[model samples]
Target chain A: MKFDFNNNIPIYIQIVEQIKTDIVAGKFKPGERLPSVRDFANETKVNPNTMQKALVELEESGLVFTERTNGKFITHDTSLINFYKQKYAEELTLTYLKRMYDIGYSLGEISKQIEQLGGNK
Target chain B: MNTILELKNLNKSFGAKKVLENINLTIPRGKIVGLLGKNGTGKSTLIKLINDLLTPTSGEVLINGKSPSVESKKIIAYLPERTYLDKSMKVAQVIKYFAEFYDNFDSQKAYKLLEELGLDVNQKLAKMSKGMQEKVQLVLVMSRKADLYILDEPLGGVDPATREYILDTILSNFNEGASVIISTHLINDIERILDDVIFINDGKIILHSECDKLRTEQGGSVDEIFRRMFRC
Candidate 1:
């Protein structure tokens, strides 16, 4: 996972966001086991306590579940993953359009830019 | 969770020079606290008083509801800035020393950490570099199953990799219900791990709060707030 830590947001929030992004993006497959908090903390260069807090948040949100005897795993519900993926896509689209609107472009012009970029892709 | 450590109206003086004045704070179990300040602040002095290296001029410092004493010392594991272990002792002998001194010292855990860090048990402390010596000291200190662990500048003069290693060891090794008070000026590096933070300047507590609450209220990281507050 990519770690882009900055001073703008708290580190634990960043961890939660990144892990959620990976799950929603299908980089970490549903039902896959997550690294133990210690291993994840070392790999991400975060404090284990901070990682534990973020994992707790994820667990509360139903994105991850602990098996008591086993470690945490991504949620096995495909519908939940799809919902998050769609929510993320919608959020990104809104962010892009909002930036273009702030630059004085109308919705029509923003759509034209999007289609042009999409064609190039 | 119980309060593991508390200071009430604590003051320290060295013959008319006041180092700390009227400091009061409580540290609860299962928390990692950052004791922060600029140079020449009373951070180290307060730490020393809690660890019983020095006596307070007034008021009291308590560990587990008792004043600083042998009982308190048994429960509090301290790592001062300077190395106190004998330089001639081998790593293996130092482990034995810890085992002999503290009932909670786990020799197996100490040996496992030493092996993980690639330290030779037969290597003499005198032959190791300053940073390696510090790591050895930290390994021994953290090997104790103490209620309170007070570390003063544990990351000083270390490279980035070793810093990460030490921080990881610290986070993983401590026991449940244990409270860690780490005193350092390396705010950015340690801020994320802190559950709460205490800012001491001119021998007074300036700010103390849960770290996330402070972050949300101030809209800045602890390092930024510290820079703004101290202007250093």
Candidate 2:
């Protein structure tokens, strides 16, 4: 995974979002062990406290889970992961459609444009 | 985490000139703090006070709940703004000196880092380039297993590669209960690694906040905000 850190967003938020994107992309397979907080902090070159905070937030959201004696891991619940994937896609699509609509494109024209874009994908 | 260093109502002056004023700060262990300010803004003065290189005019600087002294200095690994090694001394000689003087100093680790930096152990300090000298100094300071590390302008005279190595070395060195206070003007390169930032101007603190919060609130990087705040 790659990160281009921008100062406008909180670093922890960016870290959490990137981990979420990683999960969504199947880069971190379900039930895979996450790196130790210190190791992750070193790899990302961010403060360990901020990295720890990001991991805690991820755990709270259920996308990541603590395994008691073991370290953190990606949630083993495939359904939960799938649910997030669908929700994320819908959110992206809605934002894209809204932008097109604001630009004076009709719903039908937006659909046609998306169909044309699909072949390139 | 326990507080490793604190300055309570600290004040310092050089004769009639005021270098630091009414300063109050606390630093907890396990943090990487940036003491950021422009040139001649008393960053060095504050660090000197903490290291007891200069006495405070009023108030106090504390390390582990006690005033600065030989005892406190034991736990604080200080990298001064200028080179402290004798130019005639070989790199191996300096390592031996540090190992003997500072009980916490790790000569083995120093050798390892020097080798990693491609520095010859027998190199005389006078023969080394400015950047190479800085790298050797950083390696010596970082090898100490101290509770608080005070580095003044560590990235100042180094090349970009040396800067990266210094940052990485700092990242990997600190113990579980240690804290590092770095004084620097290179905000952009260091901001991402800092847990908290202390913005000093004209011997006074204009801002002391968590790096992430400041970034979030200002809607810009620390460097961007610093430019906006201190722009001439």
TM-score of each: 0.86, 0.91
Per-residue lDDT of candidate 1, residues B75-116 (tens digit): 999999999899999999999988998999999999999998
Predicted model with the maximum TM-score: 2
**Candidate 1 chain A worst ten-residue window by lDDT:** A1-10
The Cα error of candidate 1 at residue A88, in Å, is 1.4
Candidate 1 regions off by >4 Å?
A1-4, A27-52, A65-76, A96-121
What's the distance in Å from true for residue B187, model 1? 0.7
**Candidate 1: lDDT of B166?**
86
Q: What is the interface RMSD of candidate 1, in Å?
A: 2.3
For candidate 2, the per-residue lDDT at B174 reads 75
CAPRI-style docking class of model 2 based on DockQ: medium
Q: Go through the candidates in order and give each one's C-alpha lDDT.
A: 0.89, 0.90
Question: Chain B TM per candidate, please?
Answer: 0.98, 0.98
- Ten contiguous residues with the weakest lDDT in model 1 chain B: B168-177
Residue pairs with backbone atoms closer than 3 Å in model 2 (clashes):
none
Candidate 2 has a DockQ of 0.63
